[model samples]
Target: MRNKPPYALSSVDHALHLAALLQQEGPMRVTDAAERLGVAVSTAHRLLAMLVYRDFAEQGPDRRYRPGKVLRPAAASAAPVALLRELCLPELRTLMERTQESANLMVPAGAEVRFIATAESPQVLRGGDRVGRSLPAHCVSGGKTILAALPPTELDALYSEDDSVDLPRLRRELALVRERGFAINDQLTETGLTAVGMAIKDAGGSPVAALSLALPTARFDRERLPGWVGALSSAVAKVEAALSAR
Candidate 1:
C-alpha cells in the first residue's frame, strides 16, 4: 500500500475513504460519514453532494448517502445512467416519430447538461444526432428546465461556483420556466435551432433529467409552438411513468 504523501490533500483523502466506506457498509448518514473520515459534518455533506452530482453516489429518501453506481459491484447492479438511457430511448424514439423532430435526453452535470441519448429526426435536414454532447445549462431549453427545478439554495450555490452567470437575469428566466411548466430556446444555443424542453422527475419529484425536441428555426411558429410544447410534455410524462415503474 502507498503511504500518504506530506502534501496530500486531506479533503481528497476523506472523500476517497468515504467512498470506500459506502461500498463496504451501504448507506450512511452525514454524522457517520463525518466520524468515519474525521471531518466536520459540513465537509462530509459537501463531499457527498459532489459525489451525488457526479453520479458516484445517490441520496436516499432518508438523506443518507448510498453506495452509488460507481461503487456498485459490476455483476450486482447495472450503471444507473446506462439504465436511464435504456429506459429513455424508447420515449425519445416515440417523440421523434410523432413530432418528426430531433429528441434528446439530458442530465445536469454541474454548470452544464450532458446529452445522454438522442433520436434524430428522419427528415433529410434535421438536427444531427448528439449522443455525447454537452452544453451550458443556462443556454439550452432542456438545461433550463432542470435549472428551473433547482431550489433557491442550490441555485445560489451553482451561481457562486460559476461567476460568469448573470444571477438576476437567470432568476427571471427560471421563474418564467416554472410559470410556463417548460422551457423554450429561441435560437439561444445555436443560430438556426429552436427547442422546447420539459423536466423528467423521479419518484421523489426531483428533476433528475430533461427531455427536449429540437426543430429548425425556419419551421418555428408562435401559433404552433404550444402544440410542440404539448408533445414534449406528454413525452416527459411517459418518461416519468417509465421511471416510476422501474
Candidate 2:
C-alpha cells in the first residue's frame, strides 16, 4: 500500500478540532496550538479569536486559551458552575460570613491554577489575593486536588520520570490527594497561611475546579483543620450536585 499525505481538514473542522483540543488539553497559547496543529500562526489566531468571541473559549491573563462558560453547557450540562456562580454566591457568602476567611474557586490551567472567583471575609485584618491570580500547580491545595483527579498517564506527563519533587513529586502528591479526597497546603506559596481544598466535579464526574478555604496559620490549628475540610467538602458537594441536576 502506498503512503498518503495527511488528510487536509477544513477550516470549520479545524476550528472544532481546536476547541476540543483546548477542552481536553486545558489552557494553551495560540503559538503552541499552531505548532501542534501544523497550522500557520495567522490561521491559529483566527480560530482562537473566533472561539473567544463566541465565548467557546476564554483567554487567560497569560494569554493562553481555556474552555469558556459557553462550552460548559455542552461539555457537562448539569450544574454549569459558570452559570451557577450566582447560586453558589449565596453559599460562598455564607461560608465567608461564618468562617471569616477567604474562599476561592480555582480551575486548572496546564501546570498552573487560575482563581476564577473569590469571596473575601469581612475580618478587619483581611488582605486579598487577586481573583485572576495564577499559581504553580504543585504549590496550592486547589491545584493538587484537581491534579489528583487526572489519570496516571496524564499525571506522569505532568511530572518528571524520576518521581523527584520537581515533577514526579507533584504526581505523587496528587496520588496522595486522590487517596485522601482533599489537599492541604501550609504556606507553600506564602508564609503564615494555609489552605484546604476539595475537587468540584461536573455531572460527568470530571473535576472541573477546586473549592478552597484560606486562613492564617496562626489561627488555623490542627484541631480546626477537620472543620475547615468539612466545610469545603460540603460546599464542593453542593456545587457538584447542582451541576449534576442541571
Candidate 3:
C-alpha cells in the first residue's frame, strides 16, 4: 500500500490527551499536563483554562484541573492514609531538594494537624522529622494554611471558647495568608524553627492537606522567602497532581 501521512491537529490532540488523563486520573496541574503532553506550560494552561470555560474540566482550589461533569471519575480508591502517604512522599522529597530543608505533609484532624509524611534535610543543624506527630492547627505554618482555607463559619467554630488562642489575632493572620497565597511560621511553633507552607486541596476543592518546609531559624534566610514560598507552592501542586492519579 502507498504510504499516507497521518492527520492531526496538535492543539486538539493535546486537549483530547488531557481529557483522557482527566478521565484516567483524578486531577492534574499545568506543569504536569504540559510535561505529559510534551508542550509548554503556557500551552497546557491555556488548554485547561478553555476546558474549564467549556465545563469539560474544572479547576480546584489547589489550581489543579480535574474532569468536569462531562467526564466520569475512575472508580479506583484506596484508604485515605495509604493514598496520602504515597502521594506525599515524592512531593516531600521534591520540597527537600528545592529548599534543602525538612519537608512535611499534614492533614487536619478537627483542631489539630497530623503529620502524615516527613522528609528531613541532610544538614546536621536541620529541623527534625515530624512524622506521626500532631499539633494545634492554628499554630504551625502547614496547619494554619489548612485552617485559613476553611470557611469563616468553620474557622469560627474551631476557635470558639478556646482561651489559649487570640481569635481576633488569628483571624487577622489568616486574612493575611489569603492575601499572600502562602502561610509563614516565624518561630511561632518552636523557638528556633521556621516554616512556610501552602494548602493542598482534593478534586472537590477542599483543603484536605498542606505541604511545608521546615528550616532552622539561623538558616531561614528572609531574603529567600519568595523562593521558599515558590518551592512550597510547587510541591503542593505536584502533590495534588499525584493524588489525582490515585
Two-way TM-score contest, 2 vs 3, winner:
3
Residue-level lDDT tens digits of model 2 in 81-199: 46656546666776667678888877776666777677886775552653656676678988888878877776667565444457655667777889889998889987887888888
Worst 10 residues of 1 by lDDT: 70-79
lDDT of each model, Cα atoms only? 0.83, 0.75, 0.82
User: What residue pairs clash in candidate 2, if any at all?
Assistant: 78-243, 78-246, 79-243
TM-score of 1: 0.67
Off by over 4 Å in 2: 1-81, 161-165
Count of clashing residue pairs in every prediction: 0, 3, 1
Pairs with backbone N, CA or C atoms under 3 Å apart (clashes), candidate 3: 26-244
Candidate 2 lDDT: 0.75
Q: Give the CA lDDT, 0 to 100, for residue 111 in model 1.
A: 69
Which of the numbered candidates is closest to the native, going by highest TM-score?
A: 1
- Tens digit of lDDT per residue, candidate 1, span 141-216? 9889888998989889878767789999999999999999999888988899999899888888778888899988
Clashing pairs in 1: none
All models, RMSD in angstroms: 14.3, 11.5, 17.6
